[model samples]
Target chain A: MLDHITQTTLLLDEEKCRQNIAMMADKAARNHIRLRPHFKTHQSVQVGEWFREQGATGITVSSLKMARYFAANGWTDILVAIPVNIREMELVNELAAKVQLHLVAVNIETVQALAEALQRPVNIWLKIDTGYHRTGILPHSHEELDAIVALVEQNDMLQFTGVLAHDGHTYKQTDAEAIRTIHHTTVFLLNLVRDRYKGRFPELKVSIGDTPSCSILQTITGVDEIRPGNYVFYDLTQQHIGSCNFNQIAVCMACPIIAKHPERNEIIVHGGSVHFSKDSLMGANGSLIFGRVVELSENGWSEPLEGIEVVSLSQEHGTIRASKALFDRYKIGDLMGVLPVHSCLTADVMGSYTTLDGKRLEHLSGMGQL
Target chain B: MLDHITQTTLLLDEEKCRQNIAMMADKAARNHIRLRPHFKTHQSVQVGEWFREQGATGITVSSLKMARYFAANGWTDILVAIPVNIREMELVNELAAKVQLHLVAVNIETVQALAEALQRPVNIWLKIDTGYHRTGILPHSHEELDAIVALVEQNDMLQFTGVLAHDGHTYKQTDAEAIRTIHHTTVFLLNLVRDRYKGRFPELKVSIGDTPSCSILQTITGVDEIRPGNYVFYDLTQQHIGSCNFNQIAVCMACPIIAKHPERNEIIVHGGSVHFSKDSLMGANGSLIFGRVVELSENGWSEPLEGIEVVSLSQEHGTIRASKALFDRYKIGDLMGVLPVHSCLTADVMGSYTTLDGKRLEHLSGMGQL
Candidate 1:
């Protein structure tokens, strides 16, 4: 199977992926929360089908393009996780007409725009910034929050469903305890907002997402839905953050070693930033690690070899440094599986994937498409 | 025109691109060296045709897949710049049979494999490490260098073309003088190697590349050919390294402002690592700048706005920091052009480009083919 790949190709461990989905879906079931697993990580409809086998129906995506792609493939309910882009109101309306599209509103202007442009009724979630400062209206901004709720209440087409918060700050935590703490505090804040707004909007629920928080929290009390995406295909960043272990990582880049430099003890693989997006995490030694190098075997690969790490990547070449013994083991044309630091960006950069069992999974972010 | 794009799209300034190609082509002509510009930057067949208009007959690519794509598009002379992968011997034979294919060799093992498997003749350039330390055999490694040249000379089908060196170190320097110094030293070292092997290999020539070195050096002597790629779309990194001016940059990502944080003076754009890549460079303030923000207009965009910088990026979201004045000027759905730090990686991640005149240019890196 390894020999058949002539170029840098993304390999998926279907069994591991199934296990990950089962575990996360079971966790959501046990917690009595809807598992609207984010589809932005593995954008493949095939992977979404795996989620369906675990009883997942509703999903979360990062962009309208992804929502349309999944909706075209029969996903009836999809929440575009990011704050609404009013410029794409036409696309939002197109998708809203086809599926139960859920758009996020961070301000009153967005809510007003959606009300005016959306021809069909769509679920609207007010984006709440618990702590992640990247986006969303502050949870403590009562006047701003009230204005969005008031506009949604007046609009017939905009169904105010809930408040959505992505605890993106949890990704910075390096341990399960820290992530859990952030998750608990975030949920408490989001629940406070829910309590304040639930009376006026009786259908309002609470949703919080971020793989590290969802994966580490033992009990998420107030969250009505969990939208963890990276858990489906965890990577070195998640492993470093203590979200998931190495065994649960489902995707790897099978790159052929194209050049060797013994004096520097570095080998160049055909894979690079184009194959694995330039997302890096700190290694155990406190240095930057681009990816973990695993020795490829017949079935898949061995555990990441000790002292072997991808140090740098150019556009089409990855420079890997390993022990002299490991260097001696590989010649030009040998294949090695690189466990990417961040699987979401890796998956998006790869565009598609090949399951170890030989099934090809296609998704959004395909070349030549915007 | 800016209002028409609803999503993140790579915008190419056709006039600037044409000027870039013509300038580099004229420079190569004046220096009496072949201008085999690297096509890995743009990858579009239409962009390649622009080089053809500038009288460029040869091209450089990073992978065999790219070589095949260009070959199919009527590009006759294509050189795969990375170290040769013997696993792609069948591909080398196939491409060599169709076009003037050239492959890079760093060791005798690769030369031997090519000799054993290549049914059709292909040009082979010995890769020489001229202080870049990335790949290639050290120029001081005389015995190893001799063995590769000896084998290629002995083989009937293998054509010994020259010694190829990529002075990637010049990218670290931020001034033209420093880059010119590095380029001069690299050319001197490569020429020394050429003098040593020219007698045994009659076709010995010197080839060196790296956008910074090629763009900064005013007089490139002793080099037979220059393979600068990023000059076609000079980027923020090039501007910082004094390789090209800000106006020479031909590509920028048009990202829609999805969310604005007035409190933090930050605007979130719908472009991230998946679109612009994780490549960054040192800003004027000694901080890592993911990209420079330019105000979008009818024809293209303005210069980098004061105190506006793409500070960080997630998988599909870019968090840009700007002054309060700049932040207030943008609302959700407003478009801003992000000039990427590295245009090559940006172009590859985008997989295509849209000219300011509204023409879409598709390129290599199309999904699933590999």
Candidate 2:
């Protein structure tokens, strides 16, 4: 399998990925919640089949283009997890005509526009802000929330589903306890909103999604659905956030060593921002680390190598700072595996993946649709 | 043109791009050096034709894949700027058979491998390190350099073209004076190496490439060729480095405003790291800015908006921290133009571009070959 890679390739360990999916599925089952795993991480129909094998019927995506891609591939229910773009209402009508399309709304104007333009009935999820102030209506913004809900209820083409909150603030936490606390607080606030509207709308549910909280919490209460994407290919950022162990990471970038600099103890690989992205993590010694290095093998990769980390990246060159012992272990023409700091951005940049068994998987971006 | 953008779309100003190309071409002609502009920034056949209109025949790329992409489209002299990846020797041979392939070598073993594997003649450029501690052989490493050059001289199929160095340290400089100083010092070091090797190889030339050096320095000396790629699409990073002004930026991402949050003075756009990339610039007030925001129009865009910047980015969402006036100036469903921090990575991720006059341009990645 390693011999099949001649350039920079993204390697996915299928068994490890399956194990992660099973673990998350079992957790969601034990908590008595629906598992609508986000498809934005892998963005592959093959990986979506794995979720189907785990009895997942509903999925979540980040954009209308992704929702349409999955819907065309036989996914019936899809919750686009971002605010509805009114400029793309034509796509919304097309998608709503085929599948159980779920769109999120944070403002009354967007909901009214959807109600006026949507040709078919679609589920509407009010995007609520628990702690992450990125883009969501606050839980206490009763007037705005009421206005959006009233607009959804007044239209025949709209069905009010529930409230969804993405506790993106959990990513900033460094430990499991903090992540769990944030998760609980988000769930409590979302449930409060659901209860407030349950008398008028009895089918109101609470949905929360974030990798850190979903991976660390044992019993997720007060949430009707769980949507965690990054756990399928946990990366260095998740490991640093104490969400998952290093062994659970299923994706690695296999790069060919192109140049070596012994004077500065740096090795240049053919992988850079084009392959691993410009996302980085600050090392313990106060330097930015682009990725964690690992030793590649026939089957997969070994544990993270000690004292070897990708320090910087250009357009098509990655500079790895290695220790003396690690530097001498490899030379030009060798393949090195690197666990990316953020898997989603890396996967989006790579656009495709090669399994450990040498099977190629296509992504939504690689489908030539844009 | 702005009405055609329904999502995150990369918009190119063809006139500005041609002006940039002509400016660089004029600079190279006046300095009496060849301009082999790197095509890695805009990996498009249409953009290549524009450069050809400016009398650019030789081109530089970062990988063999790009070299093949351009070679198949009728480019004759192509140089792979990074060091040779020995794993893709078969590709090297295939490209060598089609064009005047120039491969960079930083070690003796690579040159030896190339000598044994090539089925046809090829040009070789010894990568020299001046001050950027990235991937290059030191100028003072005469013993190793002599061995590599001797091997290239011994091989009948190998033509030692010259010594090429990418003074990437110029990117760290903040002003024109520092960039010019680094350019002059790199030229001095490359001349020293050429003078040392000119005793055996009288036709040895010197080559250096860095956008800062190429855009700032008025008079280039001691170099036979200049290969600057980023000048064709100068970005916010280049503007911050005093290499180009905001008006000279040839590309801008047209993203739809999806959500607004006046409480936090933030606006959410459809563009994110997948569109603008995670590259950032440190603001004067000690914040990281992902991009500079501007107003989009029918023909093009306006100057950078004052007191408005993209403060953070997610996978599919960009958070713009705007001033009160800027926040209220526009509403959701309008289009906003963002000048990217790094245009190369942004272009690589976008995979295509839409001209201001509503023409679609195809890119290498968007060709669906991978």
Candidate 2 lDDT over residue span A1-370, tens digit each:
7876899999999999999999999999999999899999999999999999999999999999999889989999999999999999999999998999999988787887887788999999988999998989999999888888888878989999999999999988897888888898898889888987899899988899999999999988889999999999999999999999899999999999998888778999999999998889989999999999998998898889899999999989999999998999998899989999999999988889999999999888777744
lDDT by residue (B176-292, candidate 2, tens digit) is: 888888898999999999999898889998999999999998999889999999999999999999999999999999888889998989999999998877899999999899999
* Chain A vs native chain A, TM-score per candidate: 0.98, 0.99
Local error of candidate 1 at residue A141 (angstroms)? 0.4
Top candidate by lDDT = 2
Q: What global local distance difference test value does model 2 have?
A: 0.92
Candidate 2 at A194: error in angstroms? 0.9
Candidate 1 chain B, run of 10 with poorest lDDT: B361-370
lDDT of 1 by residue, A245-302 (tens): 8989999999988888888789899888888988887766788899999877768777
Q: Give the Cα error of residue A363 in candidate 1, in Å.
A: 2.9
Best TM-score among the predictions, by candidate number:
2
Interface RMSD of 1: 2.1
Docking class of 1: medium
Which regions of candidate 1 are displaced past 4 Å?
A: A367-370, B366-370
